[model samples]
Target: MEQEANKKRKIIHIDMDAFYASVEQRDHPEYRGKPVIVGGSPNSRGVVATASYEARKFGVRSAMSSRRAVQLCPDGIFVYPRFDVYKDVSRHIREIFSRYTDLIEPLSLDEAYLDVSVDKQGIGSAIEIARLIKQAIKDELRLTASAGVSINKFVAKIASDMNKPDGLTFIGPSQITGFMEQLPVEKFHGVGKVTAEKMKKMGLHTGADLKRLSENEIKQYFGKPGAFYYRIVRGIDEREVQPHRETKSAGAEDTFPVDLTEIETLNKELERIGALVATRLKRHNLKGRTITLKIKYSDFKQITRNQSLPFATDDLEVIVKTAQQLLAAVDHEEKAIRLLGISLSNFGEVIAIHGNSTQLSLFD
Candidate 1:
């Protein structure tokens, strides 16, 4: 029954290619076929949010420093982000998803997971639904989106990235295991650069290599995420497409032009960030019991410290004082602080479901 249920579940992952850069290119015809980068200025201590395919050819990538991006793609065009416009476009894209299924889980403005086991249009084939959706975005939004169709979210997400702009990939149930076995450990969703390197150092380079370890052994090595690696190696992912994923936290941060070592400077910056967090919480009418402070050193090593208050708060004074206290406790006498952030979480509220709720198929 479990195997049958897994086989019957139809999942699709949709990801827009270079969403921010693509949108800029679509709106500005002159940017077509050119290296367009959307983010802070190259001269600033800002990072690249997105880079066009042309820019990527020069090795410029998202999250890379804008200064490095400029060095890589000297002729790249830099444009500030237009989030409002992107959000509007995202709404249109979600509307397109709604035409086929209401079981849509938006991972971000540029990507989403869709459950079409029982599509609204009664289009039984998940592959066909993906193709049509891709075509619709191209025709109506003048943008390209890649899609992947499979039995579950994990495989579907990996498949979606396998193809490039305007591509669609369909991985059937029978192909899942073989595909996973051959996959590099680095390709797993939660495995970051450090984890991948550690895995490779341990002679575990692929899913097949990981499969050689017992679940307990993997857990002992990788901690909590090891159990996930164990199951995903065999293509066993039963996670659902949740339409109303909760907003885990709200926060803001800033990257400094020059790293600072002074306690006074750090305290002032934390005050500013705390005020921003307070404003955001009040804007959304949210009060969180836990306050977290993220610190990034000059060498790019990062750490986080959090304190849970006896009560939830959205007050600027409370937020600022708490963040300052957290910063005060960190022993950073020699380390230069390059970035500081504050966020509030643990909202004591029921998670609300979005969309027009629909009945799941018998398979679900």
Candidate 2:
């Protein structure tokens, strides 16, 4: 039953292999094939953001303390992150991806999904497009990427990682069942630490074992996420290759030097943030349907109030007024506020009220 549906799905997941570490090697030819670490200094309270495979062989991993990594690989070259350069590289890569398909969903600065059903390069076969994209990235940016070609996002994502550094793996329709049978349940998306442990206890350690449980049984064990596990294990995924959506909400946050006990001081700060938000709205030509006020206390507890207006408005006065009213309705009581932030959103839809202000979305 499921085999028929698997034949119809086409999805591609692209990931930059050791993105940050590889970038460091690309710029400096001397670092190629040598251990390279990109993150904080070993002296400071720094963490290892990424390490090259050479460094990995020495047991250096991301989020590991630089001190520990240094102890593991005494010769590892540590370098700070160049986010600006990485962002430029990201833009160049995305530009290459856009040439292939509009159904590009960027996962991060260096990874994305390209649905090549209607490829712009006019290559009907997705595998061909994947080859072209990898060549383009290598030729243009001098970087390596791994791609997973399959019938759905889950399988495609895992397939991409099958080969490391510069890799291209395809999971054809014919390979679906056997692939799932061998796939570890812990590796199934959304089944992380806690779920994996629970699944092991439930005698469901592999996708094949998961396939034995009914949807209701799975849901009974895993609650909300179990249904997803059941469907994905059967080679079923209905998700589209979502495009790079726009930033729906805009807001700013600030932490106070001292907690505020008085309402006037808090309101004053809110007024400033509101004015800033109003100017931003005018700049972007966007109106928000929901005005949200977020407040944090000294005790580390926080709360937010969201008031939905009849229609979205870009008016500064409206945003400020609504924010103030919402703040009043919350539990300010005698509690002191340590942090505050203001946000506005219409779920990515920018309501353009005036003609002069040209509104644009990130998708554009």
Candidate 3:
């Protein structure tokens, strides 16, 4: 019965191509077709948020240092992020999505998962719905988007990235099993660099290789997440397109241009970060019971320390004080710290407003 119901489901994952960079290009005609890198200036310690396809050809990628991106694509143009404009554009895009189905789960400002199994327009065909959505984005927004249509979210998301800008891919129930078998293990969405390396070392290079292991054996080797791998490798994902997903946590952090050694300096930074988190929590009417401090050393090693309160609170003073205590408890007196962060989690019961999901959501 479950298998039959799964076959009847129609899922679509839509991802805007190099979203930040593409928006920059659309607004600035001069940047069109050029290698546009959006984030901080190359001279700063900031990282690339997004790089145009042209820049990607030169090995530039998101989260890479802006300095490294400049080395790879000397001709690339750098632009500061215009989040306000991007958010407005994203709002318009979601409005377009609503014409088809209210079962839209936005992943970020530029991507989403839509369950069009029973569409608002009675389109009946998921492929047709995907095509129409892509056309509408291009026609109305003057921008292009890529889409993946399949029987499940995992397969649809993977299909969405199979092609580039303005591409559409459909993976039907009949094709899903073969597609999974031939897929590279690294290409599996949740498989990270370290995990992929471990899989390769074990001669588990493809989905088919992973399929050889029993569920218990995979768990023995990979721990808790191995269970997820065991199921997805066989193309069985039961995750839903939740339109009103809860906001699990909220926090803010910054990467400094130079490492700091002084505790005072770290505390001041924490004050700033804590204030940001408090403001975000207040904006969303949420108070958390756990406060966590994240520290990354100059050498890139990272660790987190968390403390839980008896009562949830979003007060800036409380957040700052707790973070400072966590810092002091750690042995960071001699270590040069490159990054510091604060986050509030374990909210007793709080739901983010629709369409305002966290950027860290796996479905996004």
Better of 2 and 3 by TM-score: 3
- Give lDDT per model, in order: 0.84, 0.78, 0.85
Backbone clash count, each prediction separately: 0, 0, 0
Model 1 residue runs over 4 Å out of place are 250-291, 294-304, 307-325, 331-364
Error of 2 at 192 (Å): 1.2
Number of the top candidate by lDDT?
Answer: 3
For model 1, give the 10-residue run with minimal summed lDDT: 355-364
List TM-scores for all candidates, in order. 0.77, 0.68, 0.77
The local distance difference test score of model 1 is: 0.84
Error of 1 at 292 (Å): 1.1
Report how far residue 86 has shifted in candidate 1, in Å: 0.3
**Could you give the candidate ranking by lDDT, starting with the highest?**
3, 1, 2
Instruction: Give a tens-digit lDDT track for model 2, residues 60-123.
Output: 9865667788999999999876655776788899999988888998766777888887777678
Summarize candidate 1's per-residue lDDT along 91-147 as a digit string, tens digits.
899999999999999877789999999999998999999999999999999999999
**How well does candidate 2 score on lDDT at residue 305?**
91
- Model 2 clashes, total count: 0
